[model samples]
Target: MKIHDIPGFPNPLRVRVVLAAKGLLDKVDFVPVDLPGAEHKRPPFLAINPTGTVPVLELDDGTYISECTAITEYLDNLDGNPILTGKTALEKAMVHMMQKRAESELIDAIGIYFHHATPGLGEALQPYKHPEWEGRTYWGEMHREKALAGMHYFDSVLRKQPYIAGDFFSMADATVLGGLLFAFYAQIPVPSALTALLEWKERVDQLPAVIQASA
Candidate 1:
């Protein structure tokens, strides 16, 4: 199989972490797409994925898979261990639900906040180069506040459970981990009430899978 992705980008990073956790990194060839140059927007690349998003997985049979969460689910089910996603129907439902919650409430909100507000890496991320989004104080401020509020909500959720879905570490944890890192990279300060969130991040960071994928 072949995987195309960008390093450090929150969504793509989620797929990489899943590959590492599933021990499929060595088995798959990881191709790094040039995001800054808008390579993904070009024809040859668009032929593979119309969305032109990072973390596109191509199976040996010529099937392509996009979307970070879907890729993680595909990888998890490839083997019998079934740890990253879930084994039973109920577990799968809960895992998918929690993953959706994190993506909707935290990841997507934070992305809107960052892209429309602070140009962190600036030109290195080409989409933010448009002047239309620059200096729009009102919307930027609103999205930033929404992103911060989402983090606060996640902090409360983490305080009650060992993992986002409840107990076992599932795909939801991976999604949340990448989102928090994005928040950190974007210079959003994690609130003090999120002690559990911080602790969970530390634990996930220590995993061999995380270190390898991040490297």
Candidate 2:
């Protein structure tokens, strides 16, 4: 399997963390996409993934998978260990629910601010080409504020449980980890009010898998 990814991008980090957690890093070849030159939008890359998103998974047979969640689910199904996703039926539901919330409330929110409000990259993103998100400048700011609130929400929840869904480390944790990392990278300071979340992040960061995947 070949994973088209970007070093400094958060979306690709999500898959990298999952692969690390599953101990499948060596099983897949990691290909770094050239983002600075808009290579993803060009011919060869687009032929593989019309969406032109990073972290695309290409099978040896020539099939391609885009979208972070789809790729994760595909990889998780490959092995019997469902710990990263969930084991029980209820666990699966909760994990998926929490993952969706994190994406909507935090990850996508931070992405908006990063891609739109930030200038150089914003101009390169070609937002004008997609009119649906034309006025996203203001929307990105709004989403950013909501993302901050969502961080506090997660922090408060972490105060009671060991992980996002519960005591078990699941996809929810991975999602939040990637999201928080992006937020911090984008200059969105971690709120001091969420002391528990801060501690939890420190613990998560110390894991060998997280360390290796990040490296």
Candidate 3:
């Protein structure tokens, strides 16, 4: 398998962390995609994923998978001993539920703010993501506030449990980690008052898989 992405990117980091957690990081080849150059928005890359997104997974037989959640599902289930996703019926539901919340309320929200409110990836990607729209900037700012509220919500959730979904570290935790990383790049600082969230992040940062992905 091969992953097409730019290194150190937020979404790519999410998948890379999944690969590390599944012990399959070394088994896959990583192809760099020039995100800042708008390479993904071109026809060649669009053929693989019409959404024109990065961190696309190419299977050996020539299947292309996009979206961090979908890619994670395939990788996690490959060995039959799924870890990042869930093992049981109820676990899967909870994991997916929280994962969706993580994406919508935090990561994706920050993405809108980052790409619209600010000069996101510079001039090359501007046509695809219009940075000049006054209305869009206002919309993006609204999402930034949504992201802030998301932080508090997650902090409350973490205060009551060990992980984002419950007792075990599941896909939701990984999504939260990725979301926090995105928040950093978006310049959306996590307030120090969210102790539960900060503490959970500290614990996750110490995981071997997270350390490996960071390296």
| Candidate that scores best on TM-score | 3
Q: List lDDT for all candidates, in order.
A: 0.81, 0.82, 0.93
Show where candidate 1 strays beyond 4 Å.
Answer: 124-130, 133-137
Ranking by TM-score: 3, 2, 1
Instruction: Write down the RMSD of all candidates, one decimal each.
Output: 2.2, 2.1, 0.9
Against the true structure, what is each candidate's TM-score? 0.90, 0.91, 0.98
Candidate 2 per-residue C-alpha lDDT over 72-98 given as tens digits, one digit per residue, 9 for 90 to 100: 888887877776788889988888998
Q: List the residue pairs that clash in candidate 1.
A: none
The residue pairs that clash in candidate 2, if any, are: none
Model 3 weakest lDDT span, ten residues long:
125-134
lDDT of 1 by residue, 1-215 (tens): 99998788888778888888888889998789987677887899999999877889999999999988888878998877789788888988989998998888777777766766776456656453354654655565676677677777777887888788877888888888888877887778778777877888888888888888899
Write candidate 3's Cα lDDT for 16-43 as tens digits: 9999999989999999999999999999
Question: Which has the higher TM-score value, candidate number 2 or candidate number 3?
Answer: 3
lDDT of 3 at 106: 96
Give the clash total for candidate 3: 0
Give residue 187's lDDT in candidate 1 (0 to 100).
76
